[model samples]
Target chain A: MTDVVVAGGGLIGLAVAWRAARRGLTVTVVDEAPGRGASEAAAGMLAPVTEAGYREESLLRLGLASLERWPAFAAELEAAGGLPVGLRTVGTLVVGFDDDDMRQLEALHDFQQELGLSAARLLPRAARRREPSLTSRIRGGLLVAGDHSVDGRAVHAALLAAAEAAGVTLVRDRVEGVVVDGGRATGLRLRSGGTVPAGSVVVALGAHSAGLPGLPPVPVRPVKGQILRMAGAAGLLDGTVRALVRGRHVYLVPYGEDRLIIGATTEDRGFDPTVTAGGVHDLLHDAIEVVPGVSELELAETLARWRPGTPDNAPLLGPTAVPGLVLATGHHRNGVLLTPVTADAIADLLATGELPDRAAPFTVDRFEAP
Target chain B: MTDVVVAGGGLIGLAVAWRAARRGLTVTVVDEAPGRGASEAAAGMLAPVTEAGYREESLLRLGLASLERWPAFAAELEAAGGLPVGLRTVGTLVVGFDDDDMRQLEALHDFQQELGLSAARLLPRAARRREPSLTSRIRGGLLVAGDHSVDGRAVHAALLAAAEAAGVTLVRDRVEGVVVDGGRATGLRLRSGGTVPAGSVVVALGAHSAGLPGLPPVPVRPVKGQILRMAGAAGLLDGTVRALVRGRHVYLVPYGEDRLIIGATTEDRGFDPTVTAGGVHDLLHDAIEVVPGVSELELAETLARWRPGTPDNAPLLGPTAVPGLVLATGHHRNGVLLTPVTADAIADLLATGELPDRAAPFTVDRFEAP
Candidate 1:
């Protein structure tokens, strides 16, 4: 019998399996398209200061803690997988371009400072001196020196390799249902009508984790995002720049080999994978305004994917009502950002049958059935 | 007696002197400071496309025609002043961040297309591929490939030098009043109690134009703007990023020596030239969204100035009721943009004794006197 069956092969599931196997659990990750979800299209910005907002105080705290884990997570992944996940220690800059925007930024800054975060306000001259190409139109900005980034693609690759190396079986097959016997998760039903018995099961299918056999529908649904990448001369940007361009969440993250990633559109279109023209257009428009230099770079690729979102915009973690069943989905825009924390907590539960205190607030029973 | 006594030493006055002197008119620019005014705080965006709106067709036409004159104008100035006014032909990217922004952008795009302009819609890939640092959250964008920019400080210097080189006299004194003898313009009365007679007097005092002694109050008022400058390593940005960031005009213009210019909060606060903290905050916020790399750059300077604005947002040019007294102020945010055409048209009026057809539409009579 498999000690654990994680119902996904995306970052969260692979990470969980990797950790579970490290704790000596026999684990299997079942995914039709391995490593293809929100994680694949993420900008990988470990931005707690920029991502923090109203009604997300707990998530902000969790994200800040997760950001702390990323450095060690990347180091361990490199040691285990023999490939360095591209983690850059360069900081993040949050900026505003108008009066109203500045007011909002100041409010956020006040909140960040109140939280005792090491966020510093920089005048336009100081901000532009660091990023020479920065527009002089910037009124002022906040510098989050602690906020860093890891390459999303590199992280995905490393997790897959590290998980496999840790004796976690990656089954490239669709999950049909969960086998429930005596009010407990007994195994996973494969799309090919095969049954894999497991002592415990974790549903971590990202945006597709809402419906499962014998479980009520979760509030988790697909929120499609369109992200794009461009290649240019190296060091065009040394770090991440996140901003509310007219109240929109526009971020530019520069990664390995001169690749600049721009994203995403927070959309509620359920399960739609089509990359609409408007989504791509909005991204470019906002990006170019902040970085006029972007209009000169080379176009690389356009991608669209779905992120798992819950009503509260926080991930559901820990156990379900079923005795041996667990939950880890709805990471939303933060699935990649939350991987290390999610993996550790889930592995703890799978190995010791107890959820960590850090994972307690993100319980599965927080929301009603969708 | 000078054929033309320009009652302001800003770019419009200098450009007019340069042209009128070139046409063999005895031109005297009576200005306390020649290279100052709103032109000193300008980003020098020749952007009719981003600036056009309903009821602004004539100004748009005039702007486009002025944009056409820029190349030749720059060459002529370079020849006369021996200074290379940096004119970047890289174009302008007009961006939008969210759905509402996209809708507004699409409407502008539609209007641009209807006007038969060479505006093209750019996908995220194409846009980011070009700039590489552009944020992916841009909902949509249009490339106004013909809309270019010039360095404001360089242009200001060149205009002053070129005007002096073209046989224009620079009278460094404050014009206390326009001497409208027998209800016709004759000359200017200086604050120093010196009278300089001219065949015609052109009021080009920018935001300070309203308080002239004999002129009835036009609908022009002083609108204060704060702009900023930053220095960075070379090749940070290639062009200009203009956006209505949450309905406010925010622009990022890149110039020589890796200087990024961010600017101009449109406020009705009336002649206030103090740089507020909120003003700078908004610009950096919106600008950083498009170019995350900006945070790494250096910040240089913060500046505040007053722009002469009119009710209809168009300049008051050509003749007033006082025959030899012409109105040449109220260029608003477009003063630097409209310099060349304004110079040519005003020079034609001074030389030929009649307003050009293009200048006729922008006469002071178009607006009821306030």
Candidate 2:
């Protein structure tokens, strides 16, 4: 019998195992593919300012905190795992092609200022000079030197190593259900007809952490994001460039040895991992528009993966109403960014029976019972 | 007698003198201060895409043509003037912080693509990653990587040196008026009561090109632009950053030994050259919003200069009703970008007695008679 039986093997579950095992807990993480899920295809942008929206201030705060914790987390993860997570602090440059984009950027800047955050405005020339590959038609830009990125693959690899190094067991199999005792989750049942007993159950199964038999339904839906990887000469791009191009959100993330990630097409189709040609075409078209240098890079792979998203776009980080059953799913697009904070929250809860204040707004109680 | 007697020794006048001199014509340029017009305070952006509008296709074509001519023009000016003009083809990045700005930028991109001009869309992360100082609040951006800028003061100095090297005579005095001879305009009268005899008269007086005695009302008026010169370490900004912050056209130009030119608050106060504190405060406030690094730079000087603007916002170039009195003024915000083209048109007219096709649409005859 283990102290904690985690039902997932993605970044969240692995991170939980790593954190909990470091705290002297006997933790076991189960998943069909440990490094799969959205983590395999995400361009981990730890951006609070660019990703902030009108009413998502809580998410912004959480993201910012996670971003702040990333440096120390990565350092510790590397020391523990003996693997480096590709983290780059090259910053971000938000460029506009015309007056309308500039106006929206100004409004965003004003909102940022109102929220007491610092955002720098750049005239067109300054922006282009920084990124020479940027088109000349851009009107102006804003600079957020603090927004950084990490290599998701490296992070996942590091998490795996760290979890292994910390004495957490990884079971490469699908989680069938949670073993319940007196209507409270006690452990996980593997698909191989094996039951693993534990002192507490933690479900960090990402998009699959929903509608298990006799378990409370978590309202996280599968959001399919198609991403493209390109191998290029080093220095094709500096950091990441995100744009709302014709009302569509697109970005280019550069990480590792000249590995460029041009992604991602978001679709509402559930449980689908189809890499549509239209998705690839649109990504390449927009990618070439922003950074013409992308065309010169080699096409590596097109990956389609599922992210678990909640209705309000925030993750459920703390415990559920079911006794001994803690939840850490529905991170959606921010799972990579929220990895550090989520690990801390779940570890603290398992070690000390309490969730931190940062995890308060992200509790599973926000949603109606199903 | 000189073949061309040019009034107003700004960039346009000096460029025309240099071009005409290169074409083996005896050119004389007269002005009270050769580098004291709008050229002294212009952020010489060679942007056809950003400056082009719905009904301003003709100006766009002219600007694009001038942009095409700039590389060779700069090269020739460099060889002739023995000075660097700082023509940086750093391109332009247009960024938006909110939805409104992105929508406007989309419309502009659609319009540009409709006109067969290329504009690329960028996501916010990509933009911020390229420019580190940019705020993450920016929503998205467009890339016009072809648009560029030059050091205006350097261009002016190079133009002066080029004109002098090309054997064009420079008279340091104000022209009283264009001396009309039998309705065919022959020469200019100096303010010191001296008559300058010439084969043809070219009025290149920016902002002050109209309402002189013995000359027809040219329908040009003075638009005062207040600018700030900040002395800082070099590379504070990459190129130029232009913003229509709350619908006001503002920009920052980086040139000359860590000099940043925050400039030219547009006003319709009719030749008022007072550098108001409100203007400087607003400029500094807005400049810091985009590039937080601007706050650390030292304020060197405040400059206010007048630009000659016409009703339709296009320059009055080439021929007027009076045969020998060619018109070359009313270039408002585009004098720096249009300098090369204007020089060619005026020089071609002075040398071969015909205006080029590119300058045909911007002739003085388009205006109503005064």
Candidate 3:
């Protein structure tokens, strides 16, 4: 029997398992193929200020809180795992091409200012000065100097290593369902006709959370996203460039020496993993429109994955009505952004049996009756 | 000792070896990795009439001669190899998008008419009737009912099987250079520190022909090309759509049920094999401009290879200046189209020491100073 068993081995599940095991708890993570889900496709943009919305202030605060803990978390994890997490604090530039896009950026900038976030609006020339690879056709932009990014794949890898180092048992098999007895969550039923008995179970299956048996209704839905990874762009840009070409949104994040992460298209087409040509064309079209030099880089890879979207695009991060079963999935596009905070809060709950004050508002019960 | 040793196991070499073996000559082929060069990247367009130019009448005649042999060649090869060659004779449509493109199409049509080729100029509506997926923005087009195509990879596979089945020895070793003694080519020195002795040697190394030692200057240069293969394009186009978008040229060839071959860019950058972003962007942009539905297909693959180019853009067939050293390279963009004729002509020459009348004009001695 384990002190805690995690149903998925993605970044979220592995992070929670590692943190909990470090706090003197026996942990087990069960996944057929860990980190091959949304964790593998993330661009790792941790831009809470630039990505903040009007009515989602609490989510914004949560993102800011998570962003605040990233540096320390990355340092500790690097020490524990002996691997680099590829964290960069070079900031992000959000630019707009046309009048409508400019108005949208202005509105977002005003909102960021009202929230007292650290962002500066820039004209086309100023934006181009900040990042010379940007074309001169840009109208205006907003530079969020505090919003940084990390490499998502690297973080997942480091988490796996750290969890293994922390003595977290990794079960390379699928979790078919949660084993419940007497109206309390007890263990996980494995696909290989076995069961993992645990004091608690953390369901962090991301988009698959909605379909898992023996779990209550999770309002999570699979939102498909198509993205491209390009190489041979050694000096194309200094940092991340989020742009609105006409009315569509696209972002280019420079990673490593010659790699650029160009993404992505959010489609509501339910778990379809085909990287469509239109998705690639729209991404490249807008990316090239904002930065013409993008056309000269090599398109190294194209991928499609699902983001576990909630009704309000905020993650569910606390205990559910089921007693021993906790919910830690539905980070959506911000799984990489919110990794540190989610791990700390979930591991803290497992240790102290109480959800943290900052994480209380995001409980799954908020979506249930009153 | 073998009767013949061919250096290079590409479509040209394998086809020659297969045909010569069928004519009672023991043959051996030497290559490091067979059919992974320009043969794998060829778009397989046999469009001699639609691709006709002002000064390349002899090349056009040679293309027509090979085109005439394709049906019988494909049938016999399929019978010998037990594989489909994906040969489609549904013809091709040469389309134009803008005024300059329309003028160029009209000039090409005039030249084809002067040469008494079978081609008809069509209005945009009539062109759309042939390939309904073509965009309505097309200005005009030329319908060449004789132009055809084959799947290059499928042809390579079939040729491999046919060559193997015909008892031609396949040596999976790189050819270092020709082996010459007493002023006559004897065999080939291999990269594996071994040699393949033969009665005669055939130099069919494509772009690498110029770099082989112990052989005279072959006048071949590498012309780099980048191409893409896309899937999920079932029923997108009937045959092939060769379009002149603005001043640039692009082509889309359909293979199987759901795969489309979109190509390409011609650059003189030697042997650089990186598939540039500009090349992909231009291809997708022009393909979408010609057929809007192209944007919805999946980009299955991207590849870069080099074509063996000559001064006159015609092949250097028959014997070279070196005795017992025959030449069958420099097919350029027309290797797949000229495969059958090249095989037959070279095999005929090997059986009897006389170059055919049609193939005699393309000898390497033509490039020698008078």
TM-score of each: 0.52, 0.50, 0.98
**Per-model DockQ against the true two-chain complex:** 0.01, 0.01, 0.71
lDDT of 1 by residue, A157-245 (tens): 99889988999887888998999998888889999889888999999988888787766566788888888787773767788887667
Chain A (alone) TM-scores for all candidate structures? 0.97, 0.97, 0.99
Candidate 2: which stretches are off by over 4 Å?
B1-370
- Model 1, residue B339: displacement in angstroms? 46
Better of 1 and 3 by DockQ: 3
lDDT of 1 by residue, B169-216 (tens): 898999899888887889999999998899999888999999788776
Candidate 2 local lDDT, B262-320, one digit each (tens): 77678887877666534555676666666667765656666788889898899999888
**For candidate 3, what's the RMSD?**
1.3
Clashing pairs in 3: A295-B278
Q: Which is the leading candidate under DockQ? A: 3
Any runs in candidate 1 off by more than 4 Å, and if so which? A368-370, B1-370
The lowest-lDDT stretch of 10 consecutive residues in candidate 1 chain A is A273-282
Q: In candidate 3 chain B, what residue range of length 10 has the lowest lDDT sum?
A: B273-282
How do the candidates rank by DockQ, highest first? Answer: 3, 1, 2
